[model samples]
Target chain A: MNGSAYGKAEGMKATLIHGTHDIRVSSDVPDPVIRDDTDAIVRVLRSCICGSDLWPYNSADDNPQGDRIGHEFLGVIEEVGSGVRNRTAGQLVAPFVWADNTCDFCAQGLQTSCRHGGGWGSDGTDGGQGEAVRVPFADGTLVPMPGEPDDALLASMLTLSDVFSTGHHAAVSARVRRGDTVAVVGDGAVGLCAVLAAKRLGAERIILLGRHTDRTDLGREFGATDVVAERGDEAVEKVRELTGGDGVDAALECVGYVEAIRTAIEVTKDGRLVGRVGVSQYSDIPLGVGEFMRNVGVHGGVAPARAYIEELLPDVLEGRIQPGRVFDRTIGLDEVPDGYRAMNDREALKVLIKP
Target chain B: MNGSAYGKAEGMKATLIHGTHDIRVSSDVPDPVIRDDTDAIVRVLRSCICGSDLWPYNSADDNPQGDRIGHEFLGVIEEVGSGVRNRTAGQLVAPFVWADNTCDFCAQGLQTSCRHGGGWGSDGTDGGQGEAVRVPFADGTLVPMPGEPDDALLASMLTLSDVFSTGHHAAVSARVRRGDTVAVVGDGAVGLCAVLAAKRLGAERIILLGRHTDRTDLGREFGATDVVAERGDEAVEKVRELTGGDGVDAALECVGYVEAIRTAIEVTKDGRLVGRVGVSQYSDIPLGVGEFMRNVGVHGGVAPARAYIEELLPDVLEGRIQPGRVFDRTIGLDEVPDGYRAMNDREALKVLIKP
Candidate 1:
């Protein structure tokens, strides 16, 4: 294949998805290059498996030729295209989405819906879980680190790519104000991060609905005031009892499942907001006229990570927050298959990768 | 039936729903009296047919013994129970839901979800269309008028009971602000009032979606800058084209039908809000993850009319806004059946009743 001028040699190790539960590292994947004037080639220093990646890993149909996978990553820029002025080679940066942040949606802090935006690993773009990635709209999508970050700070900054920003999206969308009581549904990386986000927003109380002791323990340390292992109606009752039967001032739906959304709805008080950042498993939310009439508003979708990265970078740099703790395991590129399996089996909270 | 000693007489003319397409004024109905110390009896002066009332008028099953029907009304206080301290006899006032506004939900401005709240014409409560009515939690539910209003001003003040306040709720919930562009998805009474409300909230542009010329004209008078006579997809397209292909900042769903809500969703820009005050005919909102991911939030429900009356009363009284212009026809107690038919047939925007 004819390659662009900027990046290093062609062949590189990258993760690929062939079929359900089948992920593999391939050496034949082409290294990313400056394919556009606004692009930059990044030598991926760290990447991680996202909870949503498991959806396709479990259900995507078989294809003998695999497709690139993974979206979250931080890296050192290897090259910059002619039009990119904000970034240069060898600079450390975190990338969120492929977005031209000048669009109206981006201007409104919804870069995920940018007019010239798309996800990684599509339309010949390199996946994050690879040796290198071709990042489009470099000036708009990448946030440069102030100085070289230590390994711990690097890992925490990597979360700004998706999870932490997503959690922040939940809290912001729910309009979590100072002294408000919030309920966060789920205890995954995003949910735990949401607890931290709620705390950061000055929430007086955070109730995390999760079953795992290990996850909830971390959640408590992350600022969850109460943990309810119960789910469904029982969870609703437990939250109500905790809130003196008034329900939380706001709720965050971090689990994509319908049951989790229902729980968030049930635990939210009348006239309050329920922020939903989960990649939905169900098409239609179950909110009905009864809920609407009671003024239980449901908002939020995909996190505009690019928009949030700037506001959160300082806190991450200064060690004001420890978002990296959500990543409990690390692996080489070859171990990505095991990483997928471990996450699927609920054995790992998150799995970080070093290519 | 037993009657208390507050009203002029027991038997009174009141509207009843006999079945679908069957509404009648029945003199056999008993006049209301204060059964509780917090109750007050009101002598009915003005009432109006609501868009929601047509739901029962069109679909309610045939019952030889009819039930109480209408809900929107304003009147003079004929008597006040001992415990009522805020209101007194001979006061002209408007009533929303029968809510004890001191409850948590009411305190939070969601009077419709008040813990001890209920609608009119249920559980031995008198319908507002009757000659005289019982108002529970009188201080919490009724807003006293500044002075006796003229016929024109009285018509406008009557709207403060439901339609005007409901319209205000839609605008408020959508968070319409100064210089914002808004779309009102319906040209009914509530829709027209929403246009007025949006204007009052400093919306620079209001696009009204409706097909009726007479109603849309009133909408224009109420401050709609543009009008689209299309429905469904065409309506969405027309509205988008009007707003330079970037949808409205906020949308108000005034029609209960699912199509109107869908239109509201489609015509709203990404990362914008759609406030819905319509009594939804469908159980599930059509907002999927795609819409959610774009940050299109859907908020609003049954308007907390009781809470809004106080905020809207001054403007209605001082002639800064004329929300009462939504009424296109007037009828007497005996002509209530005809009024219902005219409203159902779309021959009247709204019909004011003098009982």
Candidate 2:
């Protein structure tokens, strides 16, 4: 593994997926190169495993040996191309996903839908799990850190790149108004982040649907006023019962399972909304017409994390929120496999990796 | 069937669904009577066959014998129980759906989602396609005519009962803002109404997706700026091409068919929304996460027509809109069977039945 040397070099180390349940960290991976004039090379300092990464891990694709992956990371700018603006070397920044902020979709705070946007871990883009990343549309994709990065703030700021902002997106899309009754379905990091977001949005009541005591404790600390640990139809009934039979005004679907999706819908009242940000483990979410016909609308899809980084960064920097708590375990670049195992085995709510 | 007699007598002619493809005008039908204190009997002036009626016509329900049907109607009050208020004999009015406005859902302007609400022709509620109809929640269900009804305006006013308001619900639920581009995906009467609604909402551009020249012609009159007469994938591609490869800003799915639903989703750009009010002929709309993960959102369901009656009644009364034109053919109550046949056979856009 090249003596596990952690420094900028001609070659870098990266986490690569060989196939389902097969992950590897290679020290001899190629270093990033700017492929676009607007691209910038970032030396990833901290990264994390995402719930969505499980998709590819579970997918049985033939010959899927190497596919660069990981969408969440905060890093220092090491190089910038001629067309890149608003960035310089040694600056710490967090990028949501790869996007050009000038697009109409980005202008409307939907950067994930940017016309020129693409996800991390693409064929050429540097995946966040790697030591270095080539970020396209550098000016739009990265938000400059408010100040020097600190060990205590790195995890929180890192979340700004994905989970934290994604949870905020769910709340915003659900139109979570002040004093609204909200139900968040899921106990993952995103779900806990949603609880925090709902609290930030001024939801008077927040009901979290999850089971693990450890996760629920964090959820409570994040402002979850109620917790219903039941699964399936019973979970739905418990939520409805908690809401005085009127159902919550808004619901956030953070788990992609059919039952979780169903419970989210069932716990929402007529003329309400269910904002879903979870990339489902299921290919299709079969929402029956009965759900829609009741005047309950489903809003929200994937989170446009890039659009929200700037909006939420101030709160994180000023010590208003501590989203880094989601990173229950921390490891170094050599331990990327361990990070994945911890998350996959449910031994950790989330894992942070640093190089 | 008894002799066809007109007026408030021992019996009145009513359209009854006997079985699939079997419709009858029975004069032996008993006159509507006040079953609840809040109920008021109305002497029907105009009514129409709805597209949804085809659901049962295509189904093989055993009770295929008889059930009073038809929801769209405007008429004059014939009598009211002692407890009834806001309605009196000879007063002209239109009811969206049979909803008790006092219900929590109605109070919130989602009358269609009222807990106690039911569609027309259920058990005791008066079927609009009759000489007289017993309306429950007289105060909430019926909207008083803005002025004395004129023969030239009855058809337009009748539309306020269902199709027009339902179409408006589509535009409203889709959150169509003024000066936005919108696509209406259907050629049915309700689709035409959606065109009018989009126009009323001040959309800068309106595209009608349909293959019918006759319907598209009326669509243009209703403010459609473009009409793409294509079906399936070709239709989606045509819309995307017209929209600069980004797809429409908002799409209204007005056809319940799977192809139409698929086309609507495909023609919507990332981060945009598709509002559907079509009563699905299919049991479920199979939407893949791949569609949603791209950032396209789907909203709208069965429109709450009862909630929009008062808000839209003014525009209709001022002659600013001519939704009545959607009714390409007019028939008497006794000719309801023919009206159904005409609609089913695609010989007319909509059929208006007057008593």
Candidate 3:
């Protein structure tokens, strides 16, 4: 594949955020060039719009003209820089949506805190919702599969680039253990993935707090043992009753709302733990000392996506996990705004874009 | 000391709580009898009124009339039941103020949560502020020193019966380490003792948040390296500045008020820990999830007083720790109501009551 591409000059197609709900599809941009010896150019096969991307898309403060978007992607290597030895052209690999796993924070499994880690389009890097993109730390961050995966598997594998890893981190931070009862406090893709992670981590029971029938069905398929349609106190009471009045052993809070976090605490028994994966924009929500003294532990910020991809890829390949089921809809690169609308309107659990 | 014969059958004087703020000093009650084989009756030599006693005294609900009121004491054993093997007649001992120390919870070093560890007065147990009292689980709960302690040492040792151990548990729960900076969130005896505990645990810097000059002086003497006269945000800012823009490594929350707990959280750095030792009468406070996700851990509840008595007795006997410095005044059993008034009015840090 490398020999055939020597004389070809290819331009990339990308989605740019011109303004809130005003994404523009452009194809006149130069293909990403590998600036460093450890970089590789990947021909994006599949990419997906993330929930966080919607923040800038709908925000008045975001660049009104346009900027690059998208983050999650799985692709085939198109070109490799001189120092890129582990991966060859035409091989399939997935890069962690946000980070290069070589910095100090990444080494500590805190890739979300990586010094160079930032959202793709927001920082001038071509967003993953494009035809081609450059991936740094290719040797460390990109996980190559055993062989080319089928289209279905490829779409699911794309989730490992972000959402799946995020959900897994939530479970890990909550210290979910075998035989522990867990409550997932969201029903988005990440929340659905959390159910998979909790099950893989051997949680005895998983109670998903969601209202969508499709999402809840996927949650059950991903090992959610129960679902709580009611929220707040009702949700907490139902969970406690399911666990013999002891509440859950762990709760994964994927929603950033104060009420959701509170529900997580109220739904867990004393000495249990709650892992919060939401990026909180509000700081005034106080953590009551009296409640925490009952032995509740709260941990988690951004997911260390780059750190978990390689560890989770093998399970994905072996069919031991199927996180991609969260992508309830898929569309072409030009349909980005509709994907956002679907998610915003609660019409889709996740939207995958095939470039 | 076991060779001494019983002098006479006589009635013992006790300060009883007839109702809210209605204390009666009487010498009509019979001497405490050892009902269990593992019990021992002790003649109180030194006892003190605690801040917690004020709760029942000031309760809007009718305070149980004719009940004993205090729970901190150091005394000599006057009699032992048949199955008592560790303590005998005439042995100087400090019994745990709350627990038997042998139940499942007690065995797990959570004696305060033991199945039978209810409040002494409410459970029909004689209050420590009396001429004599029966101690359950005498063999496991009371620690006998090598020899008789001097007056000052005995009073300080009496603190180990409750407050001192509680402060130590707060420090332990907060994971105070050598060279770490710590903050004590209250100015009461427990907070003062937390300052001492922080010092003992090798905290390099101790910040006491209080305004009382006497308590501040004693806090400094007890190893508080710094004192913050400011309250709320100002206090948090001062602590952060003292810590070079980072917050303290640990915070000991000794006040149950909403503001005090918030101050403790605000003054602790990301990834640091906070331990709450204050007793909360209500459960409506919100646990701010955003602040907690900065990697703060909160843990602590009722202290297992019995768990620390043995470990602290040696230091007390050697005159190395002076927890008794918290006692600002001493009064006779007849002056019980006055002692309560002094503490309730913040006129005394702690009041030692003599039988």
How many clashes does each candidate structure show, in the order listed? 0, 0, 8
Candidate 1: stretches off by over 4 Å: A1-3, B1-10, B62-65
lDDT of 1: 0.90
TM-score of each: 0.95, 0.94, 0.78
The list of candidate 2 runs beyond 4 A from truth reads: A1-9, A60-65, B1-9, B60-65
Tens digits of lDDT, candidate 1, B50-114? 99999999999998989887789999998888899999999999988899999878888888988
Candidate 3, residue A39: lDDT = 72
Q: Say which prediction, candidate 2 or candidate 3, comes out ahead on lDDT.
A: 2
- The 0-to-1 C-alpha lDDT of every candidate, in the order given, reads 0.90, 0.83, 0.79
Q: Cα miss at A290, model 2 (Å)?
A: 1.4
Predicted structure with the largest lDDT when compared to the true one: 1
Put the candidates in TM-score order, highest first: 1, 2, 3
Model 1: per-residue Cα lDDT over A218-301, one tens digit each: 999999999999999999999999999989999999989888888998898888888998888887666677787778888888
lDDT (Cα, tens digit) per residue for candidate 3, span A189-264:
8889999999999999999999888888989999999999889889888888888876787889887777888888
Give per-residue lDDT, candidate 2, residue A352. Answer: 91
lDDT of 3 by residue, B1-355 (tens): 2312333358788988777777777787667777677778889999998877887778735555477767888888888878888688888887665566776557757666556665555555788888988787688767886676677887888899888988998898788999889999988999999999989989999999999988889999999989999998899899999988768889998877767777887888665567878775545433454453455556666677778888877777787889988998999998888999889989999999777
| Per-candidate interface DockQ score | 0.73, 0.54, 0.23
Task: Highest TM-score: give the candidate number.
Answer: 1
